[model samples]
Target: MQKLRRYLALGGLSVGMTVLAACGASPTATTGPAATTAATTAAATARPSTAPAASATIAPAGVTRTASASVTTPAATATRATTPAAATATRAGTVTSGTATRTGSPTALVTPSQAVSNLQRLDNSRQTWAFTGFTVAGLSGNLNPVFEYNGGNQKVTLAAGGTNLEAYQVGGVLYVRAPIGGVIQADASNPLAAPAQTLFATPAALLTALVPANTSYTVAGTETINGLQATRYTASVALTDLGFVNPALAGQGGTAATTVWVDTTQGVLVALQSNITAAGSNTAATARLDVTQIGQTPAIVVPR
Candidate 1:
């Protein structure tokens, strides 16, 4: 279970920033709800992993905010800058990386059991899934909010739904369509692609991608979802850092923490939640991705 959470956290952090860019925010704006902040001081204090630190900050108002964490590095911090905000809306937290910290917010008070229940409900509610949403909260520099993945020849789409975005994963690839013109591409050519498509292709692959390599996870406990009992797992990992892919993001004091719920009866992920903290500041954002609608099975394809 722990391994599952960690992998989901890592994959989510990696793609969170890129997806945000696809939402249509400019490259220079930093004050909106989705703005990236500094890393959480907590993550910096943890044992260093083989991967470089990936962190950012999120504010409470969903407006301009920044966070930073203390880290010793030879290089400077990377910044993901977006342009000015055109309008104001309630924004959630950004997803970053770093140590864990506690806040007085209601979301922070969520008990481990409650978190599990949320996940179970999400999983039980959807058999076939569609839609995707990404959020980043804590970091120190600028952020680009967009991500894209290719599955052989499958064409995917991310539909705009108010503040939340929807995704459709066909074939073996995933596509993200945002309010903005931004797009992201990732390689999802894995041996498990076929089986995953039968379950919930995009969501399943997404959950699997979040797990770190060579890690172990176990179901820790169970929670009831609408009278049905669901199992929960916890995993721990030191993820491989992808900061080198964009040097501009190093030393930004961001940390990624996420929780996922899988229905014990069916063994499928139903809900995903994440929190990101910036390094120095108290700013952070929390995001939740629930499977609201599922689509009928389509012709499946395998990438060469």
Candidate 2:
């Protein structure tokens, strides 16, 4: 199994807007503006939102997004759901609705290193899980691209911005549900035209693309995301390390500080955030993912 080297698809996926510079390929995942674009474009089918898909890179967009997703289950996966707030180990009081809480417990899990080892182990094995989250990019525009992945034969849905840009994937086939448009089939011959598949082509592919490497993970304490108690780790990696090297971002030497939350009890990655900085800019490029569930995989069937 291949590791998620290029990691983040760090683009807001602006509908028609272009990023200052292009991103490079990383070792774990090869994400950039293109991935987000594809996500947004396909997601448009469901609603009006998301960036445009011209390639496989994550395009940076404006706006800060917390984790929320709408899977493809007819009833259970109908609406977007938020992570129930939990008390922080360092902060005080129980967090209500996305508010911060206080506590003092270290992030629970194996050693930070061990947590990563578990991540690697999971990556190497055949598994099923589900995730719902969004990525934020762009120094100016607030573009939030959302995606939901259900492993095991793979079922995914993507949407971004606030417009009706949405799409989904099942098996190897993809479908777009544009607002006024009917169901659009994905064309493998010209992937860029239907790059949404790049985001959820497979469980392993999606995990490798969504999860970061453990090389830089360090225990950062415990936090709650979506009502789940998860151990958090902080790390810093080069933009190129995750496959993000852009003339605007990496040209100035792209470096990112990331926070990750893992469900130690279940040995699964639950949530993560990345703050990317360039040598020449004051603004930081940020991206995030919050896993909604693991083990109890949801059913993601292809669209008709």
Candidate 3:
């Protein structure tokens, strides 16, 4: 079996929008601009003072083996073994040849070290930018989210009035706090370490981290995602460890395969799809992010 080197990169982006409009009741009688102005003023004065109203929308969105053996001889055969020496040598040679055939050439099982080196080098010099936008799909809700990072440190800001939530890292610790109601607070904690920190902490940050770093992964095939051509790379990896669907997630166990799609020319990841099989069933989820607009630089707040 060939030794396969697989790296699973995960992340996603979402856009949402909310519009506010102020409408005035039809004039009770014919009115000119002056009359309208007076009516507006009167209405303003008549209306009771109130706080600003806010709304928010949110879209939240890869193995090998080896074997060895030992041999032992009985103590009773210590004196007269010369007769079987020739036969033993022949059998040993055959066994060695058979083992080689069964296990395959050493080169077949090992990836060129240069590939790993290239991947790391590319990752080191990678350039990443931040993005913030509003996304709306029909009428589910509006998502206004912000992300900040230089391919590593990330913070996410989500605000939808009562559903305001924030997640970020500080001193390598991940903290997520959200309001359950008008005044209730809830929080969840994680190790906030590498790999996990890189992928789950921020979607944009993870995108930069997952870009192939000169690590040559065999292309699985080509498929269309959201009407765009996407290339899929298969890496031998553990899905759980990669943070695709871990126990921390509600229904993540038994995830089998993960596929990522990137635009061949732009080198931007357009979509990510994962198929998970748990409890004798299969469930799949997909995340799609399109760069409708790009910003000069993302505004991120790093927690102390």
Q: What is the descending lDDT order?
A: 2, 3, 1
Model 3 Cα displacement at 264 (Å)?
A: 3.2
Please provide, for model 1 over 1-304, each residue's C-alpha lDDT reduced to its tens digit, 9 standing for 90 to 100: 9999999999998787678688876555665433333344345545354233332222332233222223322123322122223111213122111112221122333433444344334411333222222212221232222222222233322223223333335454553334454333223553223322332333333344344334454555556543444444555433233232122334554443655555444444445554544456554544344432323223333233
Estimate, for each residue in 9-53, the C-alpha lDDT of model 2 and write its tens digit.
333444213432334334323465678878887777645333334
Candidate 3: tens digits of C-alpha lDDT, residues 189-235: 33222322333434433333233343455566566655555555544
The per-model lDDT (C-alpha) reads 0.38, 0.47, 0.39
Give all candidate RMSDs, comma-separated.
50.7, 53.0, 54.8
Specify the poorest-scoring 10-residue window by lDDT in model 1: 95-104
* Candidate 3 off by > 4 Å: 1-153, 158-162, 168-253, 265-270, 282-296, 302-304
Give lDDT for model 2.
0.47
TM-scores of all models? Answer: 0.29, 0.46, 0.30
A best-first ranking of the candidates according to their TM-score comes to 2, 3, 1
